[model samples]
Target: MSSVNLMAREVAAKIVFYGPGLSGKTTTLRKVYETVRPAHRGEMMSIATEGDRTLFFDFLPVKVERVGDCSVRLALYTVPGQVFYNATRKLVLQGADGVVFVADSQAEAMDANRESLANLEENLLENGIRLDRFPLVMQWNKRDLDNVLSVEELRRELNPRGVPDFESAATSGRGVMDTLKTITRLVIKDLRAKRIVPPPRPAPPPPGSAPAGLEAQLAQHLHHRQPPATTPPASTGSTAAAISATPVPRTLTAPAPPRVEPAAVPVVSANTGSKVLGPTSALAPGDLFDHARAAEAAFIAGDYTTCVTACTDAVRRAMAFAGEGSLAQQAFLLHVDGSDLLRLQGLSTLPQLRVDDAAFALYVLMQVFVRLNAVGLPTAG
Candidate 1:
C-alpha cells in the first residue's frame, strides 16, 4: 500500500510479493518504491542477507479511497521471498489482506518455482487460511528471459487451481501495477461480498423535527447495533424515545478529576526514526503520551473538559498516525478502554496544550488513568 487519500476515505489494504530466489521479487518492489511518490509510501523495511537479499521483506502501507459515501482504511504488508526464512514468511502472512506470488517463468528456474509454490501452500495451511479462499494472484515473473516457459505449460503444471495469473517482467516494472490492481479488485470484491459493513448512519434528526421517519429509523438503527447484552433489541422498543438519542447519563459527578499526575523520565527511540515530544522520550510512532501541559493548563485554566479532550485526541490521533497495534497503540488502548473516544458532559471536544520535549512516560501514565476511569459511557453515539 503506497498511499492514503483521506479526502476519498479509502482504507489501505496490506499486500505482499512472494516468490523464490532471483525471481525479481525484490526488483519489482524496488521499482515500485522508486516509481511511487514518497508520500504514498511508509518506512520501507528491507532486510538483506547473503543467501537471499530480502531477509525480512518490504512494507508499503497504502490506502485506497472508496468512491462510496463512507471511507474505510486497509493496512498492507509483504513477506521475505527467501526460502530458509519460512518462519518469518509465515509471520508476515498472519492477518494478511492479500498476496501476490511472483513465480519465475524461466525454464531453468522451474524447480525453484515449484518448491516455492509448495512452500506457500504448506505455510498458508499452517496459518489455517486456504490459499484458494484468500485474495491471491500469481505473477509469472522474469518472462523477458531468453528461454522462457510457455504460458500454457506454466498454467497447466503450476497453476492447477486456475487463478488470475499475470505475465510480468518485474525487473523493468512491466505488469507490476496490473498485478497490484488485480489483487486490489479481488480484495474489494471480497469485502463487498462479506456484507459486514452497514450503510452509513445519518446523524440524528433534530429535536421534534419533521420527517420523523429519519428519527424513527435512526433510533431503531442504534438499538439494533447496541451491545445486545446491555441494551434491549428491536422487538422491545416501540418508538425512538426508548432508544438513545444522545450519550448515556453518567453519575452527575465524576470524582473531582485528577488535580495532578506522576512525573517520569522521558524516552526516545532513535532507530525506527520519528519525532519525539513530552516528558517521556523514545515513545513509539502512532502512540501518544498524556498532554501534561494540556492537563496542567486545563486545571490551572479551570477547564477540566479541555484537559480531558486533549488527552482523548492525543490517544486517537496517535492511532490514526500509525497503523494497527504498534506497541504504543496497545498501551494507549488499554489506557483508554477499548475505544479511545472521550466526550465530557455538556462539552464539545476538549482541546489540548503541548507538553515538554521529554515527557512521554508521564504522558502515558496520565492517559492510562484518565481513560480507565472514563469507561462505560453510553455507546449511543
Candidate 2:
C-alpha cells in the first residue's frame, strides 16, 4: 500500500525484505540504510527476541528519488524468518507495495528458500495480493559463500516469473543497492499503473491572474465595488461644512484598531500526554478550522465529550475535503481509520474521559487543520 501527503509533497510506499532465516534480509536493509544519505534516512528500528533473531520486524524509512513533484519515501521492512514466526511474518507482509526475496544462495539452504517463497505467496494471498501480478524482485544472496547454488539454478527454482533478479553478498554490501533500486522502480511503476498516485497536479496559476472556473467566479463575487461619487455639501459657511466640502483624501479613512492575539489554549501533549499550550495561531477559514476551534473551546470549557466530538468532526471534514483518490485520503485510511469517524467516536465514550484524552484529541485535530491549511485548501464556489 502507498500513501501520499499533498501537504508534504511526499509519496510513501512499503517494501518488505523477505527470506529464510540467516539469508540476509536484515543485513541488506542495514546496508541500504547506511548507504543512504543521513538527511534522507530516518532511525532504523528492529525488534528482536532473546535469541537475537528479529522477533517482529526491522523498519527503515528512506527518501529516494522524486516521483513527479512528490518525493518518494520507501519504508523498508524485514519479516522474522524463523518457521515459528510465520504469523509475525504475515503481519509484516501486509500492505507491501513491493518485495525483495533475499534467497540464501548456499546449496543446503535451497529447501529453506523454497519454503520462504511459498510462505510469501500464501501470506500475500491472505492480504488479497497475487504474487504473480505484484511488483517483485529477487536477490540470490551469499554469493561469496562456498557450496552456493548458481544464479541460473536459483532463478529457475525461485524466480519463475523472471522478475528483475540480482546476485549479492549482503554482508559485504555487494549488489544490495541494485536490488533496492530495481524493486523501488518496479513499485513506483506499479503505483502509476494502479492509479494509486495520480499524475502530479498541474501547478497553480501565477498569483494575481484571474483564475478559471469556480475560483474566477469567487474572485468576481468578492471584488469590492467602487464607492459612488460623493456630492459636495451646498455652500455652507460653517467650519465643519467647509472641512467636509474640502474633498477628503482617499488615504484619510479612520485607522482600524489593533488586533488582539488570542492566548494559547492548554492541550495534552501527544508524546507525553501532559498538559501543553495549544498553538495560538489561527487556521484559515474552512470546516476543518471551525471544527478545530470548537474542539479547543470545548476543551477549555471542561467539556471533554464535546471536545472529542468536535475533534472527530474535524477529522471527518478533513478527510472529506481531501477527497477520493488523493494521497491525503489514502493516508487517513492507512494510518487513521478505514471507517473514518468510528475510532474517534469510541474515544468519546470512555467512562472517565480525562482532560488529557480530550485535550490530546483536540491537539491532534488542530495539527490536521494546520497541515491542510499549509497546503492551501481548495476554494468552494
Candidate 3:
C-alpha cells in the first residue's frame, strides 16, 4: 500500500523485484541504484546467503519527482527467488505498490520462470492484490546469455496480459533503467487513478493587464500573510460593470520587466564526490527570503512542527520556481548537505516533534538562503 504524508508532502510506494533464482533481480536493482544520483538514493541493504544469492530481500529507498507538491519516495525491494523462500517472498510482496517480474531469458529456465510467475500471482492474491490489475513490468533479463528465449516467446509464455515488457542484460546495465522507469510511471499513474496521490494542480494563470508579476504576487502573499487571491474571470460587460466588480484586474500599459537570472551555486555531494549545481542556484536570494522568514517566525513562536513544514515548503517552492530546465527536473534531490532537505521533510511528519529537530531544519534552510545570498541577485533586465 502507498502512504501519503501531508505534513511531509511526500508519497511513498513499495516496489518489489520478483523472479526465479539467479534471474538477475538483485543485479537489476543494483544497476538502478548505481544509475541514480547518490543524493536521490539511500543505502541499499541486502540479506544474502554465502553463495551471494538473496536470502531475504534487498531494500533501496529512492526519492523521485513530485506529484503536485508532494515528493514521491520509492521503496525498491527484491525477494529471494528460490522456491523454498516462497514464504519470504510472500512477506516482502505484502503492501507492494508495483512489481517487476525479471524473467530469466535462458531457454532452460522457462519452467523456473513460469513457476515463479505463478508464485508471484498467488502471493499477490494473498495480499488482496489481483496480479492482472496491479501495476507490473516484465523484464526479459540475461539477453547476453547463449540459447536465450526470444522476447516474443517469453511474452507469450510469461506475460499473458501483455504488460509493458523490456529486454535487458542486467549485468551490463542494458535496459535496466528503462524497466525501472516504466514501472515507476505505471505505479504513479495507478496511485493517481486511485486518488492515493493527488493530481498536479493546474498552473496559475499568467499575469495579464495587472501591473504586478507572478513573483510579486507571491511575495505579497508571503509578506502580507494573506490568502492568495484567485484570478477572476475576464469581464464581458460594460466598463462600468467591470469597474464595479469585486477584485477587478488592474489595466497597465507598460509590459512586465524581464526577470534576471541569478548565478549558479555549486553543491558538492559527499557520497558521489561530485560538484553539481543546486536546483535553485539560478534564483535570486530574495526569491526565497520570504519563505526563510516564515520558517524563522514559526520557530520563534515555538511551533516546531509548523517550522519544519515551512522549511519543506520553502524547498518545494524553490524547486517549482526553478522550472523544468533546472537540475531538479532531472533529480529531486536538492543538493543541500546531501539530502538534508528530504530528511528535514521527514522530520516534519514525526508524531512527537522535537525542538532540536525543528531548529536543525531551519538551520539547513538558512544555509541554503546564505548560499543564494552570497551570489547576490543580478540586475533585472
Candidate 4:
C-alpha cells in the first residue's frame, strides 16, 4: 500500500526484491545504492549469515523522484531467498506497493525459479492482493553465466502474464538500473490511476536530503511565457529561455460567455512533433492546444519546469472555458482532485517533475483542450 504521510507531505511506497536463494536480489539492491547519489539514498541495512547469504532481509530507502508537490520515496527491500525463509518473505511482503521478481537464469535453476514464483503468488494471495492486479516486473539475472536458459523460455514459465521483464547480471550492474526504473514507473502509474495525492508541506528538507540537483535545475527556468505557434530562432536557444528572457504573456481578449454546449475539438496526433492544430472550418485555432503542444516540446527538450508551467496554464484556461455544470469541468475536478491547481504555481519544485507526472499533466491538459475546442467561439482574424 502507498502511505501518504500527511504531516510530512510525502508519499512513500515499498518495492521489494524477491527471488530464489542466491538469485542476486541483494546484489541488485546494493548496485542501486551504489549507483544512486549518496545524498539521495539511505544506508543499506542487511541481515545476513557469516557467508553473506541474507538471513532475513536487506533494506535501502531512496527518494527516486517527485510528482507535483508530493515527493516520492521508495523503500526498497530484498527478502531472504532461501526456501526455509518463506515465512520471513511473507512478513517482508506486507504492505508492498510493487515487486521485482529476480530469477536466476542458469539452466539448472529453472525449478527454483518456478518455486519462487509460486511462493510469490501464494504470499500475495495471503496478503489479499490479486496476483493479476499487482504491479510486478521480472528480472532474468545471471544471464552472463554459461548454460543459462533463454529469456524466452524463462518468460514462458515465470511471466505468463508478460509483465515488464529485463535481462541482467547484477554483479556487473547491467540491467540493475533498468529494472529499478521500470518498476518505479509502474508503481507511479498505479498511484496516479488510483488518484493518490500527497499535499506538499512547508518543511525544509535537511541538507542533502532532496533529489540531487532537482531544486537547482528548477531554479534556472522558474519563469515561463506562452510560446508562439512556430519554434523560436537559433540565437534565442530553448523555448524556456526565450519565454523567460522576454517575460511576456500572450492573451486572447475575447470575452467568454457561459457555454451552454461544449465545442467540437479536433484530434491532433500527439506523435507529430511541432505540428499545430489549425483553425477549424467554424472555430478559430485553439491557443490551449498550442500551450499543450509547447509543454510536450519542452518535455522532449528536457525542460520539465517550463513543460509543467505551460501545462498548468493550459489546464487553467480549459477550466475557465469548461464553466459550471459542464462535463469537462467535472472531469477536470476529478482529474486534478480539488483546488490543487492553485497550489501548483511557480517552479520551486516543478523542475523535479518526473516523466510520469509530466506525461499525466499533459494528458489532463489535452483533455481540457479538446473540450474547450468543442465549445469555443471563433477568434477574430
Question: Which lDDT values do the candidates have, in the order given?
Answer: 0.57, 0.73, 0.73, 0.70
Off by over 4 Å in 2: 203-381
Cα lDDT tens digits for candidate 2, 1-381: 799764445689999999999899988998998899997898999987786678799999998987886678899999998989999988888889999999999999999999999999999998998999999999999999899988889988998898999999888999999999999999999998988776774554554454555434433432321132255766667886767665432210123223211223334443565754335226524444445555664554445666676677666666555667664454464354332233345566556454445656665565555656666655566
Q: In model 3, which residue pairs have backbone atoms overlapping below 3 Å?
A: 1-95
lDDT of each residue in 12-91, candidate 1, tens digit only: 45677777877877887777777667745556667788765777767765544443543444444556666778899888
Candidate 2 collision pairs: none
User: Regarding TM-score, does 2 or 4 come out ahead?
Assistant: 2
Report residue 151 deviation for candidate 1 (angstroms): 1.5
TM-score of each: 0.53, 0.59, 0.60, 0.53
- By lDDT rank, best first, the candidates go 3, 2, 4, 1
- Tens digit of per-residue lDDT, candidate 4, span 3-92: 885433468989999999999999999999999999679889998998788988889999877676666789999998898988999999
Worst 10 residues of 1 by lDDT: 349-358
Query: Which ten-residue region of model 2 has the weakest summed lDDT?
Result: 251-260
Q: On residues 252-281, what C-alpha lDDT tens digit does candidate 3 reach at each position?
A: 222422321122222344356565433233
Which candidate leads the pack in lDDT? 3
TM-score of 1: 0.53
For residue 49, give model 3's deviation from the true position in Å: 0.7
Measured by TM-score, how close is model 4 to the native structure? 0.53
